[model samples]
Target: MSDPTTQLTVLFMPESAHGPTNQCIGIGKVLLDRGHKVVFAAERSWEGKLAPLGFVEALVDLAPPDPGATDEAAGQFWIDFINETSPEFRKPTLEQLASFVQPTYQALIDGARYAEPQLKAIIEEHRPDVLVEDNVVAFPALVTSGAPFVRIVSCNPLEIRGPGIAPVFSGYAAADPSGWEPFLAEFDRTHQETWEAFNAWVQEQGAPPLPARDFVHTSEVANLYVFPEELDYTDARPLGATWHRMDSSLRETDAEWEMPDSFAARPEGAALIYLSLGSLGGADIELLQRLIDVLGTTEHRVVVSMGPRADEIRLTANMVGDAIVPQTKIIPQVDLVITHGGNNTTTESLHFGKPMIVLPLFWDQYDNAQRVDETGYGVRLSTYGFTDDELLGAVERLLADTELRARAAATGEAIRSRGGLRVGADVIERVGLDHVRGRG
Candidate 1:
């Protein structure tokens, strides 16, 4: 039981993994240890990921309503809905944005309104002293203002600046790159519009708008899971936020995973490489087949976790060698991770200190791959249909490079020594609990 005087209630909106959602879950784990009553308040999709952590969940049906829908019908509809809705917003015309921003922002505000009755009931029933939220769920900030508690924002990867680590903030509008200089100008403008919409929503609800920096700058207690020593945020004009490194204590591997039975026969000296295309992209069947064909010819043992869509690609016997395995358990045992630069996979590879051959498909994957290249730890593949010879060359270069391997190991050690889980827990505790007191 928590100390009655020190008990807190933190409401976080975690979307799902493959983005900032899982990162929030990691943040939540630390709060759980403090005996704090942390409620993961978000779309119900998050329940599967949250249940394992022993945290309580309060789901809001953010999904659109459809009466008389079957289970499969709902899944199919949502997948298509997400796919369609995603692209439209990715490149909205200024006219479209001007017309739609208010309604879209209002819908989110409505989400808070819909949530209000339930939240009010809960609060009235069991008075939580604080509400900590992800900046993505901006409406909640407006909904819970001036309560007998504090409101703190937790920014993951921290937001964009001149040049350091570019933590990709989702729902941020992309610039219309019709012209290079103008596009650059619009980047700032787009961010301003985002803040404006948020501010407009809050102001209408009787709460003060957040500082311009509040929506963009690193929070007073932000958790940058990446090792600070390894980050090159020299271009980042920081806003006095305390930067905490990732915790090593959070890295857990099951003892039963000593070695998969399939690896027992593989020649002990052969190098092993792990490949994954991440969750969203990397669905190139021909590309995957080509990789299998090339990897089979090499002395190195190759493992591929083709993701949920792996079966779509057919593989031959050589590609099926004992070397291949799913990432669920294979990552800890590999020497190199050939991946699509998804944040989670990259972070995990870094957590293990494994060098990488990053093939970013789209979105932040490119940014992540760029970070890997800039940091001198990995090489990014163009993925523009590299010929067999070109792909082979890149693979050979990475495999033979002792320096890359050493840097990766060193980076991993640095991250591991920093107490990844504990440090994260401390920062979250500070944000979720201590920040409330600091409000005074």
Candidate 2:
């Protein structure tokens, strides 16, 4: 057993995405309060975000880039890569979808190579007891660190795989298991190609080959899932014993934000709808404008968070548009949420007992949207080829459906009943300490 007073140094290697970063913050705070030293190996921009939380931040460039480029160059390379591979530009075919994600898999390879040296330096300097990794990217770096590592699934439970389990990327529910074999076959092929390419790169770097086929595989120590079990497809297919599901890792924020004047001043009995496409999905100006136009015509008062593209759009009298809104503050007041199916947004919306119309853009968003629809608490709309009428109809249905509202409320209560942040921290601390003592 480890000394109770010993302050173990815990390190986190989270992907640069907003959802993963936010989750790191949530878990970091809990561990910090438990008298542990927390450090984050993230991008330079994350320094400001971690500083206020009292975490020691080691800035590293982990962005996936083109071959033979410096980390700084890789940052711009990723921007260009995203521009070229945005889901808005891709077709709905399985081949196109697979092609669209190839760059992401390649980026993980690039990021691992880019981050390995910095991660090694951090490990040598800090001598962390355990490394907690968000199971999206940076697997190569984590494996090379020579420290016990814990995996956290901050998004959809993709790492939990077994027979009869639907493909992680497929938006289909587990109930209809028929006719999915071909898609799963194609998905497996794509996954194998990604794994082979990454393995070859790791070999060239003189790193040991990964034991698993993909980056989403669970860690041997422990894998912490931040989502509730009700939202997962865990019926017949059982996850590994090391896998643990805790409640949502949503951190409470004290930032004060009021509803926009247009929304606040809406006529009595008008429905209020909050629309956010997350940080990445908001870049599609065409989709944003189409959503704005359609929702603006509805009797409901709409508030749109355009993320970085807020300045490019125009808002009408019944609508409000901003670069970013305090969604935590707005979610409880709204009757329904229109989102791009990002996990944070999906779980937050459900936690607040608000119904949603999910327009999944890409990645785990599709799976999350599928879960929402399957649970009878929300509706799903295709981000590609969705007409204004379809968007309006989905929103209207969610808003009017009393049964869906009841289901959402019940689900929210169930999720809240499960210990949230505290439970997640307990698991992390226990696994991390056990690993540290075992190493000794």
Tell me how many clashing residue pairs each candidate has.
6, 0
Question: Which ranges in model 1 have alpha carbons more than 4 Å from their true place?
Answer: 1-7, 67-130, 135-137, 142-158, 162-183, 188-195, 210-228, 234-236, 242-258, 282-299, 316-329, 431-440
Q: What is the C-alpha lDDT profile of model 1 across 1-440, one tens digit per residue?
A: 23335656665554333345555666566666667777766665554656667667776655455576665564455445435444433342332233333344445555654564455554555445444444344544324544332223222243443423333422121222233334334444545666677667656656556666333223333534443346434345353445544533333322233454455456755667787775544345455567777777776666676544465666544334222243535777878888877666777787778878776554445556666776777877665545777766767787678888787888777776766656665555555455457555
- In angstroms, give how far residue 132 of model 2 lies from its true place: 0.4
Clashing pairs in 1: 246-420, 247-419, 247-420, 247-421, 248-419, 248-420
Best by TM-score: 2
Q: What tens-digit string does per-residue lDDT give for candidate 2 at 1-440?
A: 23467788988888888788887778888888878999998765565778788899887876543367654454454445446667544465356446766666777667776777877788888888888888575455566567777888888875466677766667777688874687667766777877777777766655566656455435777888877666776776778788888767776643666877777777876899888988777777678788888877877888788765577787766787687777777888899999998888887787778888988878878888888888776888877778888887788777778887887888878777775766777777887778677887
> Cα lDDT of all candidates, in order?
0.54, 0.75
The superposed Cα distance between candidate 1 and the true structure at residue 159, in angstroms, equals: 2.7
For candidate 2, the clash count comes to 0
